[model samples]
Target: MKFSTAAIMAFPAALLLAWQAAAAPGQGPDAETRAWWTITEALSNDRMEGRDTGSAGYDRAAQLVADKFKAAGLKPLGDKGSWFQPVAMNEIAIERAGIGVGDRPLVFLQDITVDPSNAMPVTVDAPLAYRGYCGAAALGDVRGKIVICHGVNRPGLPGAAERIAAVKAAGGIGLATIADPGFAIEPPRWPFAYARSVTLANASPDTDGFLRLRLKADALKKAIGDHGPDAGDLIAKGSAGEPLPGFDIRESFHATFTVKRRQITSSNVIGLLPGSDPASTDQAIVLSAHLDGYGFGTPVNGDGLYNGTLDDAAYVALLIRVAEQRRGKGYRRPVIFAAFTGEEKGLLGSTWFVAHPTLPRTSIAANINLDQLRPIFPLDLLTVHALDDTSLGDDVRAVANGMNIAVQHDPEPARNLLRRSDQWPFLQAGIPATAFVFGYRPGTESERIYRQWYRTGYHTPLDDPHQHIDWKAAADFNRFFKTLVERVADQEAAPAWKAGSSLRPAGH
Candidate 1:
């Protein structure tokens, strides 16, 4: 269904006016912030159904953004000169699964979660081994065994990929990683809405048949009852990144799985704001935010919709606001506004965009991605990812310092957050990029608010518009973003990879 510009603007315009009227003379969000919220509310309201990738809800949201882009006087830069680049995807989910140790069964999604795969075996009854961190040295001759390892998300510790490779090479059929309890910055959240994975439709499924699973720290005792080292002691050692004993469980592990698979199509909404200066028109600055959310999921407090207000709806709205603000006059460098899909699934959309950009890949100057940002507290500081990798960091620091906002490199690198968002794909492609998080000092009220939001609102229904917001913080970040973009887009030199940066491609 197509919507006229008038029809599309009608609802949001009314919402903006209502929000403005309700604002106390001087007590609420500023006018610009109110406008930003109006767009956010329109995209994140229950009516949009959380904008799940490839769903009608997402399509509706995409069309709305395209309409806004058209009204903003931006030129469509998607496939076939339209405002969207269609991306084909394959989604897989676990319908039901059971995992057990001896006669004890672990709860699905509560005690354990498995990665869904088309190549998953129907049943496996194999000897179990506790291989500590599953490092190559600890993994003994475990032919046809399921290995359990401590899941540590920090540098210098064996991570998931390395552990999986070691186990697979050692002929292990499965791996269960015990969730780390010591990572206080971002502790694990349980009862995940569901276990789902999405990949580009053209990508081949893994045929290796190795099972991947995550075990709750509290459930470790039950899973290894009377078979291996004491669960409590092992967890303590692993959490502290200490060496641990590797031993075989006396009892065999059993598992059965049922998976559902389907193919779907989603799109990235793209628009081009042509540079006013013809000399710099070929160099485009890409501004991006993901539009996909969890959609409906296992109910938390009887509300299943993951509205994703700040997880990204708010940032997408911010992109639209930027387009609207510069409708008639674009920056010196062309700006590509991309509302990407399938970020929640795994950065699929941006990956696709980088591989198949609407414009020449060489012309993309830099990307300033907006995700993983929360304005629940004052924006006293900003944590910039890739802060040392490229000149973009210098641009951010200059703009932020003017606003009295301290800029710092990622404080929590163990989270592996730098590789977790849309900006990652661009960086991998040798395009200088950066993303941000509102920073806080340790043990402060600001830190408490930031942590609390991740605990309750990060990916849950609690991320809706009704949640408390720091109006000043929201407005301040918006201003900072606007200024940063102008500075980067108007600057004479294109962003460059810093010397000695590992991410810089040859000749870049």
Candidate 2:
């Protein structure tokens, strides 16, 4: 049951509708879920080619969204009064690379991965230093070495930025952070399709000759063979965030890289549904989801396309469903629908949009972002990011409660998921915002399914339409999203930040 772009594009309208309706009896999606699945299937089918930013496939998906918006009676609210806002970006990818420690060669994207940067050297042979956690105090005399640090994400542990700065301050040439295996809430994923980076076109690229690398946890021992402290003990202590002594490894590091760079132009799809009331019409409530994915990448289990069905294609479809349900009606406040690009490239699309909004920036009242919302299992509980930072949390909690769904604040804040999506950009701009994840108690079947998805499907070729889905859960969340939107849009006052929240920006 695979579909290709050419075959789908060649089908007549009636034939296509018939094909869509030919699902097996009793196995078909529920009526409530059918429309949502239809849109998702269209966007995520093989023809779209994973919808990578600035690619032809992304353009096709964007056009489909724009057509849907027009049919739903939404007005163009993008740049130059069109349904598209062009975003210029610079894309960099590692065309080829190899790394080794002493005589042991490490497999690229398997044993280790290098973060692509223009500043990375084509070849390097430097001494290695093991600085536990790479904390400032532990980074002593790492000058000209490739520093190794434990990648711990919990509080009190020096995070990536802190470790990188400390290494640079100690005159280190590169840093390799071992992927922590102890973080069970969200474990590190391996075999990245490729190493790439996309940044705003006008932004300055990293010019310093400092390399960033992520070594697979299991590879740490092999990388340090008989050179320093017992690798097993170091991993155990580092995973626990326990202090360990820093030492220079006797092994030297060597690597060569072939990098490619290109200029790309991706667009954000924007549409507006005006408000019924004149007074509140100026203040818009934004609904957003990223439309970019990894596109074609290194093959996994013989599949190369990263369809991104649940990662975000499904939610983008959910947005279209919302617009269709409105059917030309306006809420009390204007609603802006934003289908963003370059989210996988570090939230570049949303960041650009926030900096250069089509409408006045001050007119944005709030943002209800849709990303990382996996309803693969039952929709019994939801983990809400920024749940306590703004009144938007209250709105969502009330809505979920009325629907018999439990809502909890992000239980694993150390994942920093709160700042990983489009919502964070809105939050940074002083607009109330939040996102969600389907929650499960530890040791539940739902938890297993969630973790399995993260391990096999997340950012992989397995994230396609063929994957198992809880249709009932999907419908339940769709209803919840629509209800929450109406409740916030029709409310008299705009959502506000809660007092004493650290996330709150100055001046309201």
Candidate 3:
């Protein structure tokens, strides 16, 4: 049909609209993040692309935190007693990584790639010995040889002190897993690729060479056995076992890598509650929580943004409430409230803050750290990390007893979650700290009404206020912490780290 000038203009607009619709799913504003996000609205919006350490977004976030501290009436820890405490850091990303078996070049990610959890860069020219699994037996001197291990072995193998004799005897340089190598074969017969994950937690290779691989255990077993014990070896020594011919490494090779590392500056936003007593003000109790998240690429349904609402946003809000409550009550000792950044990046903000404090770091008494506190109900039990070594434990027991709440150690120690939050900074700096979280796992007896609300909304973009949270439960926890902090702040006694802890840093 012949169209008029008006119709012609509409066509371009219509095409543009269609293009937008087509790209909607994969490309759009991060809706889920926008929903669950509770970061400072100003900062999260202005720097929503993510506050990457080196990006302008980070600066915006810095300002928001500083403003919060200022509004809260806390003294600044910056150079001239300002709010910021700077830290140095360096960020790096992997450019290229490959493996080699003799002259065959191993493919990337699918075939073999180093795990960054416990990442290191290096070059090697040596034969490989598949140690089967990197259990305790895989230890020892693996000075110049490649030692093959399963992904599970990198964490300490049970009884590892004795088991790694083989690695020690052979002088191996590193140990790794080759479970599923870089790619896969489909019916059409082309290979597809997938990357591997690694961590320093389980990566216990004695030598410096660090890497991870994807492989089928039983299949690799047959191939290595058939080709001699060196069949699937990436570094080329003879791997023993039946060589499974159809199983292909596709690619495996190694080259020298120049690792660049650096430390960049970061900060912590803090406010305070001046005590009624001058002496007591010097000895303070810390109230803190991490103020950071996955930043981006965080899964919020289809949105790649991490809205850390219950992840600690709620805790931040609670902290504000507690501060408001204490402001009404006239504290006897200083109450230091810190909203720390760099928690997702490795607890750098708190670490730096404790190193350079606003008041006498030595006088600082204890820390009450709030995290992932989307309470579904008044928790019947309370969780504590590092509770064994300090007077804070006594305080917790007393307070929990008073509230009739069972005080328990971290139920999920496997996650190492106790040491995983912002509190670890204060703990490492000689302050006793406690972090609180609540949830009922699959098939549990918790009939608490808030359980259902917590189930679906914990970490997603849906964790907005609408996600059924027991505000009453949140209130109870707030009251519990407020009472706990009030008692500590009023007490003249100092809260200290348990003796024998490797964590107590000097001058803390």
Candidate 4:
């Protein structure tokens, strides 16, 4: 979802001209481009209804991809000889929540936004300890206290989840985080009508239950009395990325949360192209992309549907194109094409797939996940997630180099993108995995366009097929991705984690 721009300008003038020439509409694209467009356009069409996870729209989209897999002669690798691996999910919608300090009641979403994570019901009344930013230095005496943290977390430091994990480890009863308005990627501090959590009905809670919320500055200021550094000052300082100190707020906070739950199931479309070589046939190269989008959300530009055309549907189309192009042919290792559901919902589908694989867990050799390939600009560079963690990174570089596209490491690690996508589960399971985003160097038109897409179209109705797409760039990327798959599948050795990789499993 980010880029680097100066590397783009380094391309030769003739290369730019050729790229422009290839993008012209009347020139007509070849079969791969046409196929990719046809599938992407169809998936993003109104008929698909944004393909929200666990919705009928998503079911229809899954069937559509399954039909394509069938047509391409890919064998079903899903449940009960069908083309879908069903995943059970529990949807939790917050009904109501409240917070209070002394006589002042903090209004929901306006005065604060609470975390909807429901391991068990949450109710807490505890003394507040103002733990500045949740940094190590600020966490000294938070045991059994309600810790107040400024901002989600410091940049280049632990994220909200990680900080909360530390808090739980420190025996904190609850946490309240102040949001920073300065970060462009931060979502608005609006009330969430509902939230989702994995339905691990049989498992015990991972940690002791706690109250977590993001408090508005005004509300916190009122709650803390006429305190040192009013809420506004604290928020402003946090916004400017300044360090804060811990102190006892000398107030008791009360919170209560409630949620309703319903069980739902989503399906991941799984198909496999069998390997020809006996030695490698048992191993599988998994190609993945999410098949779900926002579905319906707060309306954007007068439209409610978040048709994820380039955010994914396009990459799913690329998967189908690979199936088509590889028809009547075979790789050395089996190639598994998986269009996962619930990527927009905490990578649920892929997580389920890894936990309950259609094939043996040991058979998965590697994962190459695709998502949000913005071809609005030229495809001069590619960003490979986890670029330094596995040999799959080397494979990606070789493929990109062969296609004359520069390969770049992720430019925005703060996004935590490597752990955000479907590839993450595979990596966590000790499989070498990677995901890609189109790259642009800093200070280029490519960077501007890329930023513009995220700001305006990302998760919005503007992401529909009607949006402009550099078809030639799409074609180029599809080709490069297809070759990358081929190279991985044909390689003599299965993909491997690099030594000293933090993601590497013990003794791997």
Encode model 3's per-residue lDDT on 1-508: one tens digit a residue: 3435344334432242243234323322143223223433444442444454433455566666666656655566565667665555544344455455655555443344444432554565565555544443434444565666543322333223333444555565454454422211100110111122211222244443334334443334432444554444532221222122222222233444444444455556677767778767667878887665544543433554544555555565556556544443557877777877677666667776777676788778788888856565446677777667677878877887897777776655544677778788777766778776654433443432233333234333444333434444555576678778877777767676666755566664
* Per-candidate TM-score against the hidden true structure: 0.91, 0.92, 0.65, 0.81
For model 3, the local distance difference test gives: 0.53
Task: Report how far off residue 345 is in candidate 2 (Å).
Answer: 0.3
The runs of at least 3 residues in candidate 2 whose Cα sits more than 4 Å from the true structure, single-residue gaps closed, are: 1-28, 242-245
lDDT of 4 by residue, 318-339 (tens): 8998898777478999999999
Model with the higher lDDT, candidate 1 or 3? 1
lDDT of each: 0.87, 0.88, 0.53, 0.77
Best by TM-score: 2
lDDT ranking, high to low: 2, 1, 4, 3
- A best-first ranking of the candidates according to their TM-score comes to 2, 1, 4, 3
Number of the predicted model whose lDDT against the real structure is largest: 2
Between 1 and 2, whose TM-score is larger? 2
Once model 3 is optimally superposed onto the true structure by TM-score, how far is the C-alpha of residue 337 displaced, in angstroms?
Answer: 1.6
- Superposed on all Cα atoms, the candidates' RMSDs to the truth, in angstroms, are 8.1, 6.9, 11.9, 6.4
Worst 10 residues of 3 by lDDT: 183-192
